[model samples]
Target chain A: MTHKIDIKNLNLYYDEFHALKSVNMVVGEKNIIALIGPSGCGKSTLLRTINRMNDLIEGVRITGEVFLDGNNIYDPGMDLYELRKRVGMVFQRPNPFAKSVSENVAFGLRVAQFKNKKKIAEIVERSLRAAGLWDELKDKLNRPALDLPLYQQQRLCIARLLAVEPEVILMDEPCSALDPIATMKIEEMMVELKRNYNIIIVTHNMQQAARVSDLCGYMLLGEMIEFNKTSEIFTNPRDKRTQDYITGRFG
Target chain B: MMKLFSEKSIKKALTVIAFSAIAALLLIVVFIILEGLPFIFKVGISDFLFSSEWEPQMGRFGIFPMIIGSLVVTLGSMIVGIPLALSGAIFLSEFVPRWAMRIIKPTIELLAGIPSVVYGFIGVMVLAPLIRDYLGGPGLSILAASIILGIMILPTILSISIDSLKAVPQSYREGAFALGATHWQTIHMAVLPAAKSGIIAGIILGLGRAIGETMAVIMVTGNAVILPKSPLYSVRTLTANIALEMGYATGMHRQSLFATGVILLIIIMVLNYTATIAIRRRVGKK
Candidate 1:
């Protein structure tokens, strides 16, 4: 019932290039909100703004308010480390560390100074299971993470994030690097994950958005063209552009 | 009429050119072993390797002191060099801006071109005297040799490490940041481990240079043939032994210097072999 994240008039720029313009959206609690757009439409930009991951780029400028848990994340007093802990991200490519499978899952805990070896092992097991990779990976926990197949590597990246217990998960083209079967597995995992955590995903596949998300937003050229319930947006979109986009007329 | 060059002929020519370097290495190994092995056998490998005496007239030619000298100096160089090189590489690759690195990287590389003899001269004039006055040993001691050699090998370590650190993909950094890890934590946990193999390779290469170097080490290490008791004590490395005595030596004594070269050669091969195995173990993992 609560809006877990609230963005109002969010504007972002990299040097002189305006990357996101007036992006306003309410991300409801425990729901998977999907952003669908053509490439370079700023869907990924909007997702990065939530976790402040875009701050790493030099010459990036932002003039907006992003409220997370009712606190403005852009406020000067905000701790970046704490904010990032609450908002985890999965990249377009799976980037598991060049470490063993168990170590990859336990890295976040180790950084947080969680010293109990038994607890770390237990949590590693739970996180991998949550990512739906436990059945395939349970016996090979000590094997190098890089040796895993691409799908398992991606799942390991998810388990890495999950181990830190983030409240919001941001995924940018998470399944683009994957084939259909692995994509389906991840899509199902995301839907299951929404029972506990707020999820925001930026994706290119319209079918994926229509299938997995409860709420969907269509964006074009750094602007949000439409936002509605997934069923309503697909069947009875009020915007001519949204209709055109869904019906394969234009981006 | 123009004639076409066949791919097979070009490939064959290039293979021969590529293999010539290895063939030359084989020739050198053959020559050194032919000259030195006889003397080594007569002296007994253990006596040549483990005994400390080195008197040519009295028929004693033990090289144990030189072996210890080389080891101690190389160890000292590593002690001083590895930390500085690693930190410099990390700073260059991670902390410095692109524009700054453009200037700094080339400048760090330029440090490698200074000749060894010039380094030796500088060490004699400055570093040796500094150590002699401050650290309480004769100016020419193992410590002086270590300091100069450490600086000499810094560029090799720095450049290789920088390349390896830079090879780590940007995605790893993003993944670590997303986990709420701080900048230092991301670098320490993610970047360092990913770049470990490269860093160790650089260290091994530097260690090789430290062991093989002769001029600068001899000038500063006082060239004493005693078994060194401490860093403050004077010593003579294997390379220094051959370089200093090869011109005056004859018969078994001359062959003993070549025998020293054989030992140096074996040591390098062992170091390189270990490096290859270590790197293979870390290939895709890093």
Candidate 2:
């Protein structure tokens, strides 16, 4: 499989505390990869580093390389704007902008300076359909995004990411705030999305990782303990620490 | 068996206290209206609203110029004060570190506590002459009044705008940044829109302060009885007119000043009502 993202010896720190320590992993193209860890284990921090979201925080220091499409993202001359345009992110909780549903999906395209109104409208509809929310929300494009139900809002956020046409989608516990049914819908959506875009999701739910991801990485104390196919990692793991964590021996 | 009081009694007492406070405010309005009603009825409504001549000794009581002066001064203050206050608020809320916030927040609060009279004295002794020299006026005009009023209302606008901007959830900003928005872009698109109603409320409150302000404006505004012809022209605002001439005037003259008070009250009431409606609509949309 061709690698879409390659992280080599990446380390991240917030002030004095080391958050991600020398993490190395490669995510294949158009595949779903899940990072499973307990709270404070740096799963979210690792996910954020892929898109440079941690740049907003003060006293954050990063070391090593994150290559997107064979180019080092940490290169001093790399434009963050263009990099982020190619790599989109969805948050844990639904965070639709204080705008209409159509406007929410159109936000990134508008920011990227796409002036063709017809093209924007077509993309909005296509993105909504891709996220499997078009049938329910087709008639209410003018409604505020926040007025939607939690599950629908999450899907709308997904549609918004899709509108940007990013190669990779990073999700930080995207279904953590959702109910079981909503989580199931999102899991189904992820399987469908894998045909077109590479996805890296950090989740606390071991079963979710088992169900939705083709590859699973088990992390603890800011270190990657094991990375393998999800079936092998769950059924025939090599590392004892990975086994203990997968079986819920200790978080 | 141990309970001596019912829930109904506590509810009743709370309702009565709340209504009483509201009723007390209404009574003050009614008293002002009743005391000023005789002159309003005698002079008719159109003259009181549109006439510019306000000679109390000769029984001429036109309040149009003072009304125009109040409008111009209040608008000037808002134009100057809102942007300064908003920028100060954004810096305080978004850029200032936690340790620095402890020092800066209180300094702003200290501005709010400074007496209006001290602000008046500053305008009279310092700012008026500066404007006179630089802007080429009589050291006291609508421009001077606006400058003084703007300074007086700065702390109010800044503190409230900061609170409103802080009240916006961090999730919105994170969402914008995660979508690749720069700091200023995130603030402009997400943070400012979310905090729009609160910032407008702060501006409206500052406007109320400007419209009703007396001592500071009276000290610097030349207090001429004519409407301001320009930024450098002298004028007397509604509040200043009342404050300046209310003493020693007898009968209908005193009543006419009270009528001016009624007119000022009505203007502020309209402004407050519009602001309240706008804020409610924004909150509802959110």
Clashes of 2: 0
Q: For residues B1-286, could you state the per-residue lDDT of candidate 2 as single tens digits?
A: 3244667777889999999999999999998899887789899898888987788888888899988988998998887788789899999999988799889888987987788888889988998899889989797877777777887789888988888898888888887776667778888888887888888988888888889988888888888888677888888899998888888778989899889889999999998987797678667855
| Per-residue lDDT over A126-245 for candidate 1, one digit per residue giving the tens place of the 0 to 100 score | 999999989999999999899998988998999999999999999999999999999999999998899988889999999999999999999988889888899998999989989998
| CA lDDT of every candidate | 0.91, 0.88
Error of 1 at A153 (Å): 0.7
- Chain A TM per prediction: 0.98, 0.98
* Best candidate, lDDT: 1
> Candidate 2 - CAPRI tier?
medium
Backbone clash total for model 1 is: 0
- Decoy 2 TM-score against native: 0.95
Specify the highest-TM-score model's number. Answer: 1
